[model samples]
Target: MAPEYALNGLFSVKSDVFSFGILVLEVISGLKSKGFYHPNHSQNLIGHAWKLWNEGRPLELIDICLASSCMLSEALRCIHVSLLCVQHHPEDRPNMASVVIMLGSEIALTHPKQPGFFTKMESHEAGNQSSSTNEMSITLLEPR
Candidate 1:
């Protein structure tokens, strides 16, 4: 979920894009984005991916099941595209159209800026974590 939506109860197309980005990363890693915790780094999935990508070890983000069969280049591309979609500012993210083009071609991608919501588990709560998410989405109708 986008931080703005979580913090301010507002959502837009960019917010859905943010959710889509998380979904892509989850698909690649076979882990839920919201609940993933890295004990060593004290970071969630986005933070973990950002760290791995910056350290030149992005393949670590790929699921072990696909470790041998997945093409490194394709997996890296998906990571890159997903990162772009999760930039901290909605304006910094590519809309869905550019996302489609970026996914389809070998065009050089701009490096992603830091993603939002890099929350960490409290030191005492890191390992004893539960499988629940802090889900906070709401929908309502406004009278026109």
Candidate 2:
């Protein structure tokens, strides 16, 4: 979750950008952004990615399917770009235009700061939760 939206309930373009970042990571890692488990890390996917990135092992986040086919530099570039999108503050996140440019070029990317809402959920806690309010259970709305 974007910190502002998660904490204050204000959604904006940047919030969408934040979601995009997590989705990108999810696709690359073959894991859910939230409730991702690894006995070794005991942290969510975002935190795990950050940890691996700092340790110069960002490629470990790539799913095995992609690892076999994807180029090392390209995969690392995607991870780097995703991290920039998920920065702790909306202002810190690249605008869509910047993101597009960043993805298309080999230009140096600014190192990403820690991401927001990065935390662990033990298996029991993670599995027992109900759907979030942000989810729309039904197609249409009704007047209350």
Candidate 3:
């Protein structure tokens, strides 16, 4: 979920863009954003991707299965566009049309600003955490 929608129940085109960015990352990494655990870090899949990107190691994010089949430049372009889609501010994110153009062309992409909702958890804190996700659910039906 986009940070604004998750925190304030607000949804918009930009929120959908955020979701698209996550989906792109998931496809590239072959990992789900939620329940993503890294042995050496507490960052989720998005945070991990962002870190690798910032460190000039974005290619490390590609799934091993795709290494032989995918074009490296195309993969890098997708990563760049995905980052643009997930900018911290809604106004900074491009519309769907712009995103489509970006993906289809070799236009130089602007550097992405920090992503929203990337609060880092202390490694120890992450390990000591319980199963609560801070979300509540109500069960209305009983098993037959």
Candidate 4:
């Protein structure tokens, strides 16, 4: 069976795109960022990056880990592309083909729409429930 977070049945290709975007940010930042947090703020890392981009301060969100080694333009472009993958509507997200093209070329990119998650209030609750159920199922099957 596919493990949770395996991006199997739980996620479509678009979802994988979202995950890839998150992974890129985590790799650059050396921080694990989850999508559902903050009751008042519906924005996750992608949303935060989008906001920063809109404010013309995208660099502010860069990881301190890259402070000395990272190229400014490349890092900014990665962030911009990551935000594009996490757009609210799945149809708005680019397929892997277009994503590669966007990354490889200086093609004009579209602005991302607001991300999925209608509210942040249920984020923790839902995650906890899913994890708990998975654990329980495992425990029940183990030999006592």
Q: How do the predictions measure up, each by TM-score? A: 0.86, 0.82, 0.84, 0.65
TM-score of candidate 1 to 2 decimals: 0.86
Which parts of model 1 are misplaced by more than 4 Å?
A: 132-144
How many pairs of residues collide in model 3? 0
lDDT of predicted model 2: 0.84
Q: After superposition, how far is residue 2 of candidate 2 from its true place, in Å?
A: 1.7
Deviation in Å, model 2, residue 87 alpha carbon: 0.9
Instruction: List pairs with backbone clashes in candidate 4.
Output: none
Which lDDT value does model 3 have at 144? 94
Tell me the lDDT of model 2 at 124. 70
lDDT of 2 by residue, 1-144 (tens): 788898998986798778888988999999886547776756778889988999999999999998999888988999999998888799889988888898789999999998876776766765543545685476787899
Clashing pairs in 3: none
Candidate 2 has which clashing residue pairs, if any? none
Q: Could you give candidate 4's per-residue lDDT for residues 1-144 as a string of tens digits? A: 111224334655587777677777676666556533434455555555666678889887777879679888888778878777766556777888898998888888877666543234345553442323353443456677
Give the TM-score (vs. native) of candidate 2: 0.82
Which TM-score value belongs to model 3?
Answer: 0.84
Q: By lDDT, is 3 or 4 better?
A: 3
